[model samples]
Target: MSIRRRYADCRDGQIHLREAGDPANPTICFFHQTASSGVMFEKVMARLDDRYHCISLDSPGFGQSYQPGEIPDMRFVADRLMEAIDDLGISTFHACGHHTGGCAAVEMPRAYPDRLESLTLIGPVLVNEEEKAEYRKTFVRPFEAEASGEFLMTAWKYLELIGAASSVDLHCREMADHLTARDTMPMAFSAVWNQDVEGAFRSVDIPLHIMCSKDDVLWPLFERAGEMRPDAKQSIVGGSDFQPDRDPEGVAKALGEFIEGLA
Candidate 1:
């Protein structure tokens, strides 16, 4: 069964979370990417429901969540998320993140290591300042040309192409619909520009699992993550950018085995 919850009085403002499985069980929170929301994890959650209490939230300023006038940097976003976790009364939980969400997960464990049982990152973006500046100029700026209509259309088309090429599911296609290309463009660019994954990894001493798709557009990103955290275990999925979405059962099985090994 699926249940949706909204917390309007969160420290960082209002947020929406979609949940599955038993609340009393140990929790596993999934943080989605820049242009996506908790909905992308529905299928994954379904597969893991028997083993985990899964919850996925739309980050502040994305999806149904309230956006503060000022966009938060990665650190601030992590802080707000910790507060949201406290609001949920969850003392300790496993955290999994995708793309930008992985940046937040890295920061969260660094800031509050005591609250996390383990951390998992999928296709993370960990780049240096110079590379970040170049990304903004080359990719982000072009995408943000129009704040809405045309930009969103083009962005969706790009996502469709990626999904088609990767063989991702209908759920991924549907979740991609909620994102406005330009609306998230700024945040996406800023998050990558402002990330300090190496520093964050160094700050937290915890079990880390990094998963990547070999053929993904973000494959280089996972490689960067692996290089930064040399000791962390890495798992490579054989297909497309949306490996977790494309192979939910495989991803879930890998994740479960990883978590069990940690235990």
Candidate 2:
């Protein structure tokens, strides 16, 4: 099925979305990783649309979504996302997020417990107070665009470092997302870093799925996540960090099976 790009209104502004499949099917709302947009979930949405209604959102300050007026915490983003989802008339749905998006997902159960049916976290940043402190120092502020256009290479190199850009095409695609949200990308990262994601993860009382690829940078945290929520469903897919973009088949299979099993 073809993906339809649209916008949903929220208190802040509009949230850009890519949707597919029949609305009659159970819905799975996807949240993309930092510096990327809902476009990252297109392939996976296409693969799973037959079994589920897929709605992937471009979080506030990312992609085509409105930029946040200030550097907000993950909770703020999560609440705004649910507002957009509510605007779409989805009363209940599954929530899946990657990295930064995962941070926002965990907060959803706390703020809107009745709305989320389950939570799926892909390569979530599970860090302690000390670790968060150190990591927050890495991106204390956003990078300034250089006049010589060298900032473009900086963004490309950053994506490569994170395993999000594995090829020329992928790099180009992600680079555009990075530059498009250049001002707020760092703010998003800061929000994730500042928030207590580990605490938020522990607070989720509903069904949960924690996933990561072996080659993903957060692979080390996969074990830690399992230890925290041993009862949660888990899967290890084949891909770098950008699994939905690079390994949609594996992602869709794992995600579809988990969601169906819950039913």
Candidate 3:
């Protein structure tokens, strides 16, 4: 598959995206985890090359894209995302998001119902006030940089713990994703923390596919998703927290089946 880096000018700001597969085919837009970027979707897109125009967008403040000041909530993130897609001349497309990206996935249908064919939310992470409070201490709140540089190592350690069973290459790439957006990690976390999982899914009129790794930090939330929407498709893939990275082939295979069914 041919891969190209592209950009789109949206209402909020310019956004970066990674494009692959053939544009003549149906489009499938992907979003990555908080503190992560489009890099994670490469393998998955490669697998879908002949069948779909796969795209992975870098969320504002997380990749080469500029932040949209104070995000406020997930709705704003969804709107900004749609703006970029619209600018790309994609009137409608299937949407996929992982972790924090999953929050945006659910919101996108609500933001632009007519523009979505389906939604695939991987490890949809939603935290209650108590979980948010605990994460705040770990910089779910705005992170204050320390001269001691513990903040920098904290990212690495967190990746190691979450992806303990993943390959070294996966860990290094994910670590880089966070370090590259060090300033906005908290902002992404904040948006995800405020998401209403049940409310968002309840509002989705389109078909949905929810999947998670047995080892994802948000696997429990993924289970809740199954309970909330029993009729929607669900799966438990094998991998650690970085399921997309650790199990791209599995992710892509599942995505291919789900998307083909949409046709």
Most lDDT-accurate candidate: 2
Give me the overall lDDT of model 3.
Answer: 0.82
Better of 2 and 3 by TM-score: 2
Clashing pairs in 3: none
Candidate 2 lDDT over residue span 1-263, tens digit each: 88888999999799999999999999999998888888889889989998889999999989999988776788889888999999999999999999889998899997886989999999978977787777777664545687898878777787898776577888888988988888888788888888988888888999999999999988988889999999989999977889998899999999999988987
Among these predicted structures, which one has the highest TM-score?
Answer: 2
- Cα lDDT tens digits, model 1, 1-263, are 56655563477587678888898887998887766777767778888888788888877777677776655578767776777778888889999998788888888876786888898888877777777878777555545545456855566566765563354455445435345434654765576676776688666678889898877677887888787789888987643656666778767877788888986
Q: Residues 55-162, candidate 3: write the lDDT tens digits.
A: 899988888887766777888778888889989999889999988888888888877769989999998765667877787676574435689988667667777778
Clashing pairs in 2: none
Could you give me the TM-score of model 1 versus the true structure?
A: 0.88
State the local distance difference test value for candidate 1: 0.74
Score candidate 2 by lDDT: 0.88
Q: How many backbone overlaps does candidate 3 show?
A: 0
C-alpha lDDT score of every prediction, in listed order: 0.74, 0.88, 0.82
Better of 1 and 2 by TM-score: 2
RMSD of candidate 1 to the truth, in angstroms, is: 2.7
- Candidate 3 stretches with Cα past 4 Å from truth are none
The lDDT ranking, best first, is: 2, 3, 1
